[model samples]
Structure formats: C-alpha cells, structure tokens
Target: MSEADGIVYSDVKFTRTKRNTRGTTSSEAEPTYSEVRILKTHPSTELPGSQQHPVSNGGSKVTPERVVIVVLSALLAAAVIALGFTSLDNMHTKQSFQTLRDELEAVKRNLTERHCEVKSYNTVQQTSPQPPVVKENDPCLKCERGWEQDGRQCYYFSIDLLTWSESRDKCRQKGGDLVQIDSRDEQTFLELKVREKMKNDGDMFWIGLTDSEKEGTWLWVNGSPLNERLTFWSASGPDNWAVYNPDGEDCVMMGKKAGAPDLKCWFDEFCKYTRRSICEKPAETGHFTLQCV
Candidate 1:
C-alpha cells in the first residue's frame, strides 16, 4: 500500500510472509521479529564450600562395592575347589580298602580246596592189595633154603642141628624169631608144612615157645605170650623138671615125628647151634611176599 495510507502509523506492525520450500508449498505471512527482555540474573551462585569431585565414565573403572563383590566371589571359588579335592580323596581311600578285602577272600578259598585233596589221597592208600605164601619146593617161595611158606606160616627142616637154645638164637638174627603159632589157621598151616617138607631126621627143632624168663608162663620171643588154647604142649608137658635139673624147663622143641613134642631145659652156654630153624612173622598187610624197608 501507499506509504502508511496517508496517515503515519505510530505503533509498529509486523507482517509475516511465507515462501515455498523444496517439496512443500506455503501460503502464509512471515512472522515479524521482536526484542525480548531478560530478567537480571544474580552472579552465578557457586556451591558453598569445596568443589565436587569429578565423575569418570570409564567402563572398566573399579569401585569399592565392585571390589567387595569380586573378593567374595574369589572366596566362594576357593571353597568349592577344596570340597572337590576332599571328595576325591575319600573315594580313593574307599577303593583301596575294597581291593584288600577282595584279595583276602580269594586266599581263603584256595586254602579250603587244598585240605580236601589231601584227605582223598589217604583213603585210597588204605584199600590196596597183599602178597601170598608158597610151598618150599615151589619156585615162587621166598623162604630160607629148605624152608616152606604154608598159608601165613613158614617152616624149615634141619639136618646138622644143635641145642634148642642155639637154634633159637640163630633164627632171631635173620630178621625173624623161632616160629610162634597163634591162630588155628596158623597152627594148621605149620603142621601141614612140617608134614609135607621136614626131613625124616630124628632131631628136634626149637620153636618160638619159651618159659625161660618166667617159669610156667610161656612167652614168645616177640613178647606175645602163647594163649593156652593155641598151645601144642604135649599132655603133662613142660613139667617143672625133666631129663634136665630142677630148674624149670624153659624151652620147647617139636620133632617131625608125631608124639615127639616136648619141653626142654637147656643151658645158655649152648647158643651157637648150626641147625636150620624156622623164622616167622605175620605177613605185612599189603603185598606179604614183598619185604618192607
């Protein structure tokens, strides 16, 4: 409009105009600028005393609280490690004890088996075999020359003889004594051997029967006394005195001839007779023919 429309305006008037921007169109007036009054501000008021300490933004900065937490965590970790070691040690100790117990049980089982085997062997040895006796003339006979084994008994025939005491002593030296008959089977066996094998010579041979050590009490040299029931003493034989002096008759002789069994008294001075005499012993239980060491 013409300058102030012919009248001078005293108050300031503001006019606003708008302009189009790149993609926006505007149809408005521009705003007028005006002066703004600011109230007076007292000199900046400072904190009353010392300056505040600065704060840092470093991400890794350590604070007192954080240090305390870290220390506590370290203690926890140490406790955990100690507990683990204790458990492992306890397990190891238990394993060692179990191993020792197992070994002891195994040893006990082995010992029991060995004892059983020994008992079985002993039982078998008690039930084996034995040997037999043979006639003197038989090739299998192991008796002294001119001797015969009948059943369990052995007999001999004498040609050159001596006093009964001498013959008895000689028989004892060869691992035997003059024959002593104890059982019916033994007596029968001896009588048969004499009948079948003796020479017809009239000489009498000493038997094991003797009363020398104690008169009237017959005892075999082997220390077994003759039982009265098994004796071959002739009737009224062994009378305290005989063709010899009053010293009780101590020895007995049996002749090959029937009815010639007699008790004889002899002096110890005649103990060196060179007569064939019978030597007898109970056959050992097993393998009677084989000699035992």
Candidate 2:
C-alpha cells in the first residue's frame, strides 16, 4: 500500500488453481490469494468508497471575501464613469458662460463708441460759427417809387385840395386812408413833414377825425372813439365856435402856426372845407397785393 495526501486503499482476492509447485506433478496448491493496493494524490479526488467533494476551477476555490471585493470594484468603476460625465457637463457650461460674457462685453463697447460719436458730433455743431440770416426781400425797403417809407409804413402827400369826404375817397382809391396818428413819435413826424409843405397858416391838411355824429363825441374814421388823453387840440380851439358859420366845425386838420405851443397843431373845421390830405398805409409784406392808383 501507498499513501497520498494521507489517504490509501487496499484490495484482497482469493483464487483456486492447480498446484504448480511440483512443475506438473503436484496438483494446484490447496488455495491461492492475491492482494491489490490503490493510491490517491489528494483526499478530494473521488474514490470508490469516499465521499464526493465540491469541484474547483483551475485548482483554485472561490471565497466570499473575493466575491465582495469584485462587487465593490464594479461599484467604484460605475462611480468613476458618472463623475467623468458630470465633469464634462461642468466644462461645457463654463464655456457657454464665458462665450456669453464675451458677447456682452463686445456689445457694451459698441454702444459706448456710438455714444461718443454722437456726443462729438453734437459738440462740433454747437461750437461752429454760422452766418447771419438776411432776408432777401426786406419789408423796410418795400415802398413804391413815389411813396415815402417811414418805420414800416408808407405816406402819400397830396398836391390837390379837396373836401374831407372827397379826400377820403381819393385816399381809398390809392389803397389807403387819411393818416391816423397813433404815437407822439408819429405826431412829431407828421409835424415836421407838414411844416415842410405848409404855404401859410391857413393852408392845412385834413386828417381822419370827426365829431359829425354827435355834438361833441369825436371818433376816428374807423369808428373807434378817440383817446382824449392823446389829443393835440390848440389851447383855445374846439370851442364849438359858431362865430364863423351857423353850423359848428366838425372835421379836424393839422398845420404849423407861428408862435404855436409845442406839439399843439390840431384845428376843427367844416367837413365841406377843401384842403390837401395826407394818406397812409402799412408797408408791403408780400402776403397780398395792393393795387394803388
């Protein structure tokens, strides 16, 4: 018998045969016996009268500790993959944010440049000198050939004598009316101009003032009542004097007299009295046409 891994097996057998010890003369021995021995390399190897054992792969047995190690390794690998994806997503997000920031900066720079340009243009416009505007057709120079212009108005001095009514009609035919003196400046101007045209104290020019409607209520020819505060009546006239004729003088005239009070040159007379007249109109403004005689 032999031993292997502390396991051994033995076989014993008995056989009946002719005795051969005497070479052909003696009968077989009374009985013959034979013995056999079996050996095994390890106890786990299956034997005729031994219990079976669990098999192993490549002579290596599996253990619970190794299985746990393998499962843990699988989980770690999955975690690493998930972390990699998360990192990639974070990187992409950061890039997108950076790109947006760059775009915003560019837009801000463009807007700032445009604003500066506009400011510079406005400054140039404000600082540059501009030429003065001159009107092509000045109203001050618009008087006709025969009419005399004075302060935006034109005057026509008549040479023929006529009644007050006839004189007003003639002035209307020339697109004007008898002069209405508004200010002391105008009154002074008329005084100086009439002083140049006077032949004698009796020679006078009929103005557009009358009191023919009532006894003493004077009014301009345009129907507005006279401003009594600005009248230029002589010191001792407008007395409704009835000495010269039965009817009182109701028309007004302007003239220069010797030794007269300063700016006192107005006198009342009959409407039927004939006298030269002074006509007036506003200077042309090109808005409408005035057909003058």
Candidate 3:
C-alpha cells in the first residue's frame, strides 16, 4: 500500500516508570500519561474511477497574503533608494545656492568699494584749485568781453575821454594798462582804433609813453626809456606842443594817420587832456614772453 498522512484515534493501555524512594529505599512505579503522534496509511474514500492530481512539497506555494507582503517589501526598498538620491540632490542644490549667495555678496562689496573710490576722486577734484590752462598753439590769453585779441595781446579802446593818468587807472581797473607803442605794427593798429572813435578833427588817443618824469627823458610805465632812434614824431613834434598847457606836453599820442596834415606820428600832449585811450595786455590763455610789460 502507498503511504498516507493521517491522524488515528485509538485507546491504548498506558505504561508506568519504576522509581526508588530516597529514605525507605523501596522500589515503586510512577504513572505516566501523554498524547503521541504516529504515522499511518489510510485508504481513499473516493468513488471508483475518479481522477485526481497529486501534489508535492515543492508545489505547495505561498498564499495571497504572503505574496502581497513580498511585493510591498520590494516597493518599500525601491522607495528608500529613491529617497536617498533625492536627499543627496537636495543637499547638493543647497550647497550650490549657498555658493551663489556668497559670490553675489562679493560682487556687491566690490561695487561698493569702486563707488567709494569714484566719490573720493570727485571730492578731491572739487576741493583742489586748478591752475590756468595755457593754450597749446598760442602764447596769447583769451580776450575778455569788450577787448580785441591779436596775436599775443588783447586791446581795449575806450569811448569816454579821460585824462592820461585817469585813463591808465581805468585800464588797470579793467585788468590792463594804457597801450605802449612797442613797434610799428602796434602803432599802426592804435592809429586805426583811435581814428574809428575820433568822430572829428583834433580828437586824439593817449599812449602810455610819457616824459612827465623829466623835461626830455621819455619813459614807459614800466620805467623803461624809449629808444630815440625808434621815435615816430609828428611833423616837427615832441616839440612839446603847448596849446592846452604850458605845464608842457608830457603825454604822447598817435593822432590822425591821414588828412591835410599827416598825424600818424607821435606827439607830446598835456597829461591832463581828456582823450580816448587804448589798453593793451598779454593774452590770458598762454605764457607771455613780454613779462606783462
């Protein structure tokens, strides 16, 4: 017969174990009772000719609950791995953000420093006094209003007549002095200017040259004496004409350059005569070689 797995219920006599008493030294039997397991084969109660499939230990598989538990465990493990990667990515992103913040702060610091430097430079420029700028191409300064510029000199022709001394004071107030005829060019120019303002006969222009210091010794305002050889006398002039004052014709003038009597030459006249005057000075824009004489 084929072996079968089953439980059989049957009554059987129980056995007793023998034991010895410690004091009396008498032999005695101990009663024993227990439930036991036994292997047996049983006949099948199925109908004759019925078909059935045999199952082996290997074929006995896990239940639905156990399968569900295994699946859940696998999903949990995958989720844990994904979470670890996510945590690493988050940590890396935080590090990058911190680095960016630090770089931005550094840039801000640099900008602030640069701004401060610029401000400091501006402050210095504002506090310092700048020297006059000389024009590169010319040694003449720029003429102020009411003055005319020529080469390295600026000229001013006065309309209101004033005494020679008074005219010189006026010119000084205007940042200049009476025109000194240093050359023929200068003399010619003054003659033209005086002619333009004359308006009639006997009108004159006072120059800076004067012999007021002595009877016949002519000196410029700068204390420089005139070169007699270079003198431009009108007709028989520096005759110390005394029509206006016998105190003597001390001041010099360049009269009419044209007319029945030529007047383009120098003539001595009274220093007190009120007449249009010319002012001359070195140009303000560049180095003057004339020493402002």
For 3-26, candidate 3 gives per-residue lDDT tens digits of 434655555546565545555443
Better of 2 and 3 by lDDT: 2
Q: How many backbone clashes does candidate 1 have?
A: 7
Q: What is the lDDT of candidate 3?
A: 0.71
Give the TM-score comparing model 1 with the true structure, all chains together: 0.39
Which digits, one per residue and each the tens of the lDDT, describe model 1 over residues 18-77? 666675657676667665444443555777785877787666877999999999999999
lDDT computed for candidate 2: 0.75
lDDT at residue 293 of model 3 (Cα atoms) = 13
Error of 2 at 270 (Å): 1.0
What lDDT score is found at residue 251 in candidate 2?
A: 91
Clash counts per candidate, in order, are 7, 4, 3
lDDT of 2 by residue, 186-263 (tens): 788788888888898888899999999997999888888989889998876687777876788989988885664377
CA lDDT, candidate 3, residue 180:
73
For model 2 the TM-score comes to 0.49
> RMSD of candidate 1 to the true fold?
24.5
